[model samples]
Structure formats: C-alpha cells, structure tokens
Target: MTDTSERPRADLRRAPERYLSRPEEGIETRHAFSFSGHYDPKNTHFGALLACNEETLAAGAGFDEHRHRDTEILTWVVEGALAHRDSDGHAGVVRPGMVQHLSAGSGVSHTERNIGGAEGPVRFVQMWLQPDAFDAEPAYGLRRVDPAQGGLTLLASGMARDEDGEALRLRRSDAALWLVRAGAWQPLPELPSAPFRYAHLTAGSVGYRTVPGPQGGGRSMAPGDSVRITGAAFADPVAGEDGAELLLWEMHSPVSYG
Candidate 1:
C-alpha cells in the first residue's frame, strides 16, 4: 500500500512484447489490426500477470479457437468492440465500457473476433493471470464500468456484491481491479495500499511523482502506458491528470501459486 501522505511517483520502463497470434498465439503484433504487449514476462514480469496492450484489430480478423489451462484471463475493451465464443457454449459482445473474464481452470477453449465495422478497428486490453490452483473449473463473467461514479469497483471477486462488481468470483488466488478517470492533475482517493500496484493508462497522460529515486524525480507516461510498483515503496503515492483513464490492479505479493 502506498502511503497516503506520500505522492505517487513512477519510472520510465521500456515496453515489452509477447508473440500471441491466431497461429502460435503470439505475444505482440503491430501490423494490421495490431496487438502489442506493453509489458509481459518477456518484458517485465513473466508468468505472473501477462499484460498485453492491444489495439486496433481489423474488422473480421480475430483469433480462432485456442485452449488454455490453469489460467485466469481477462479481456478489457479500451476502445472498440470484441466478440467472444467459448467451449462452454457461451458467446457475447464486449465494448469499451466493459471487461470480460474467463477462468480456464482445468482447461477451456475459446476465441475472439473483431466486432467493429470495416472502417473501425477494435482496441482493447488482454491480461492473463497465473492461477494459484490448477483446474478450478471453467467460468465466464463480465463487468461494465463508468469511472464517473468515482472510487474503485470490484470487477471480479470471490464474493458477490449488490452492484456491478458482484460478478467474476474466481476460486484461485484473490485479486481485484479498479478504474479511475481524473483530470490533468488530481489525486486518487486513499485505498487499502495493498502489496502490489499496477497502473495502465487507457487514454490521455499523467505524471507520477514519488520519493527521490535512482532516476532523480519520478516518471511520466502517455496513453497505452503501464507501471508496476513494489518493495517498501509500495506505499508511495502516485497521481496523474491531463484527464488520464487509469486501470489499477492490486494483487498478492510473490504472486501466490498452489
């Protein structure tokens, strides 16, 4: 948890790539309907949380059926729309305002396709979380969000809530996600200051300030950027503005596994 009194700061990190495609399920792509992993094990934290910064999937171009086992995957639409089909006989469309979760416990097969029109491309985020337990049972869920409501909304949890966060309770390790839309310069409300903190900018830009570090001050980032904070600095404050749309993830340290 970052200290409430300390300001949030960050450092610049070279982005990463993972070859995830329709064929090998390559990690990163930049050509047509491009998909890129802003940060992943190949770049940052490997086998922990696969954060693929995806954007602009050409219309009609999508992934074919693929299998996944013992992985907790979440698909977040930052801009356009994406359609999903799974072996469980479930199918649905996801737009910019919503997130979809698929828990491939033992094993599950699924595919994603662009739902945007010919002229419009699909832009979104795909994350893979290593489960603490294998083959927990396959499940699917979704959560629509609006940062205008203020504070964090639990997108998926082990328990049910009365509102939007009520869905997506997994049987593996516990984790929660939140979204915030702030001006060019605003502070995030105090949080539990958990052991892990990750921020991804959906749109706009912001400056993250924190205690003096090896790089001097802090770091600044534009849209499609991400950051991971750890060590005792976990409690340091991080703020942004220029109307940045930020996605935050708090996970257990050491990334527990069963």
Candidate 2:
C-alpha cells in the first residue's frame, strides 16, 4: 500500500547517507529510497518517484534481463557508455549528455551493461516513476542534449505544457524531468512551482537554498546529493567553482497505487 500518513516538509539527503548495495563484484549501487533489501516504510517514495539509484558497473559487467511493468524508467549516464537491449526490439548506446527512457506499459524485459570498450567503470543515475495508467503499449525513447547550452532543458514530461515534440513523452501527466548544466558560479533558472519537487546533483557541486520555507538555509551539495521539497519553492542554486549538472523533477502529487 502507498504510505502517505507521514511526510517531511523538506529535507536534504547527503551522498554518504544513501543505502549502499553491492549485489555482486564490480557492481555498486546507492539508493535514495527503499529498494531491494533496503526497505523503509516511511521513505518508500517521494512524489511520483519511487526509486532514485546511483549505479556503477565495472567494464564488462551489467544487469541481466529483468522484467518491469507500469513504471517509467529514466537513465542518465555520468561517465562511460551504457548499452541497452530490450524485448521491444530497441537497442542503443547511451552516453553522457544523452537521455534514455523506457516505458514498461504492460510489461517489458531488458538488459543494461557497461560497454566493453569503455575506458573505465560506467556510472549512471536511474529513476523510476509510477505511471498514471496501466497496460498501455510499451515504448522507448532516446535523446541527446547539449549540456553546455544555457538554461533548463526539458528531457521528459507528460504535462500539457510540454506537448511539443522536444521531450520524451511520459505516461503520467503530473510529473516532468528537467536538466540544467551550469558553469562555475552561474545562477540556475527558476524552478517550476509544484507540490513536490526533487533535485539530484549528478555532477559537481552547488550552493542551494529552499525559499519561503523553514528549510531556507543555504546548503552545499556534492555529487549524489539530493533535495526534497514539499509544498514549497526553491531559490535558484548557484554552481560551485567546478560547475554543476542537475536533474530536477516537478511533480504535482505523490504516487497512488489504487
């Protein structure tokens, strides 16, 4: 059952505080929410998001075929390349600056592996979102982005405002994913107002602050850090000296499995 009895107003989750899982040699994962054997009833989900995982796979290692249904899976590669193959006859190589989305409508089976020719270990962040409708046709989408370009780029969305052909389409209308790659000391764009918002730092550091709320204190966020905002807005984050890459989610509501 979906847990909605208790929820935080807003909070920061640091990198080291995440749940660590090393299912096999050369494969490491850090989960932001309850997953696999790390279950937290109060922390089962935030907004429509169910899982936010940071994964690293050594050369020639990867996840075997797995099945999923009624979930929207999004992946962002941090370094190296990820090779994907699925039951729907879709195959591709996703690298940094690319967005990969898989919609497990009714059901789908897939496998992900670090490319054998990668220079080193492959690292990526993968997130799962609950879909609004079930048993629809499965689909796949891939898009390459120029992170150096200024401003927030719409990566995936199901909202009416994003009906344009720019973003990968999702099956849920209450959520959207955005990306920002800022230069050193650059101010980020204003975030979209929503009941629930989550920001994950995929690369570099930033000075961030939540606005119009008790958790308004300025904070520094390193790679793997995340901020969860509920019924509040966030001030524009400033990139650190080394710059920053962020993946932000704007959701109007939490997940409901009725």
Candidate 3:
C-alpha cells in the first residue's frame, strides 16, 4: 500500500451550473453553491465566501430592486452591460471587462436590469461574502480590467496594506478577489499549507493544477465550471484551445455565512 504521509492533500471539486439554482426561468441563473431555494449543506460555501451565481438576463427581463445586509456583493459582467441603480445614489452601467463591487453593509437595496446594449442579452457572475465589520456604511464601486494586462489582477481585497495594489476595496479583512485572463502559464501567488482558494472559469476552457508539486492533479475546465482549492496552492493555469477567463478568490477558511 502507498504511504499516506508521502503526499500533500487537497480537495478539488467541480461545480456544475445545474447544481445550485433553478434553471427554468428566462432570466437564467445557475448557482455554484447554496442559494435561495436551493440548499446543500455540503455545498454552502468555501472559506469566507457565501455565494457565486451565474446570471443571464433576457432582452427586457431582470431582477427588481432587492435588499441585502452585512454582505459584500461583487458583480462581474461577462457579455452585455448591466444597468445598476442602488439606494446609495449610484446609478451606472457595468460592461464587459468591468467588475462592480457593492457593499451592502448595514443594509441597501439595488436593482440589476439587462436593458442590454445592442450586443443583446446580459450575462454576469455575482458573488457574496460577509464583511468582517458588520453594520458599517453602504458603498459601491467598479474597476475596468484588460486581458492583455497579464497575470492575475487584484480587483478587490481585504488586505490591510493599501499598497497591495487592489483599489476596488473590501470592507471585510478576510477575503480578496482576483481576475486573470490566461493565455499562457500564469502562476498564482504563494499560498499557505492550508489555504482556501476558489477558482471560477467564467469563459473559455482552462487547464489548472491545484497544488504545489507534481503529485497534484489538474483539470480541464469549461465555462461555468469551478474548483475549490484547499490545503494547497493552485499553480498558474494554462489556457485550453481557447484562451481562458477567470475570477479567483482567496479567503480565510471555515467560511462565515451572514
């Protein structure tokens, strides 16, 4: 028998689109974890993250104004533009390559509509996480990302040092989100022995290695597929036949759900 101590252990899971949300609506939504009416104890969350939903809006259909509290909401546009209006006096349109972050601290109400551009329907991914400090002020912000930028870009972070280069800031001090467009090998930051990393392939396919050494395994990813990395660091991923588009999040483990 092989020795158990000879290798490092990591959990690599593939989250399919149909696993977490109702797929029957015109405004299609496929959740990656427990959300709304779909609940799975074992699939609730990872680290400090609570929800990641892949959403597509019909020509004129969209979510009416909704309310949230004590949550950090991030909306990453994938296809068309998303018209967003919030109670914080911020009304804007988020387009592809742009990521919007809304802190529903204390409490806030917002609306997302496809009112899509000439491009047609609107597609995007929304993630929610608990803020380290609850009942704080509500806030909203956005950032533009370019695939040619190379390497992983820190779109949002809870890191104490502002010099870390993430400007779309987070009120929570326990999580960060990154965006990477991998055409070639682009390695990730060094991770601790026991780390919590969530890698989502929003577009194109990706070939990723989730651990530090050769003993670790890799997977071919498709759009909407994601992997949860634990106890190991994910190396730079390589793009498949088509280049890859991704959203990566690193957070403190035993995810806190709000």
Best by TM-score: 2
Ranking by TM-score: 2, 3, 1
lDDT of 3: 0.74
Per residue, candidate 1 scores C-alpha lDDT tens digits across 1-258 of: 122224343434433322334333322242111224232332434224544445457667777898988777777887668889999987889987788888888888998877746456677777776666675778888777654455555565442332344556654444566676665466555543545566666777766554445544555667666666542342323455456676766665434434
**What's model 1's lDDT at 180?**
61
Give the TM-scores of the predictions, in the order they appear: 0.76, 0.93, 0.85
Among residues 3 or more apart in sequence or in different chains, the pairs in candidate 2 whose N, CA or C atoms overlap within 3 Å are none
Model 2: lDDT of residue 87: 98
Model 2, range 79-158, lDDT digits (tens) per residue?
99999999999999999989999999999999999997776999999999999988999999999975435668889999
The true-versus-predicted C-alpha distance at residue 92 of model 1, in Å, is: 0.8
lDDT of each: 0.60, 0.87, 0.74
Which scores higher on lDDT, 1 or 3?
3
CA RMSD (A), model 3: 4.4
Q: Over 4 Å off in model 1, which ranges?
A: 1-11, 14-47, 116-118, 146-148, 158-167, 212-216, 231-241, 256-258
Candidate 1: lDDT of 250? 63
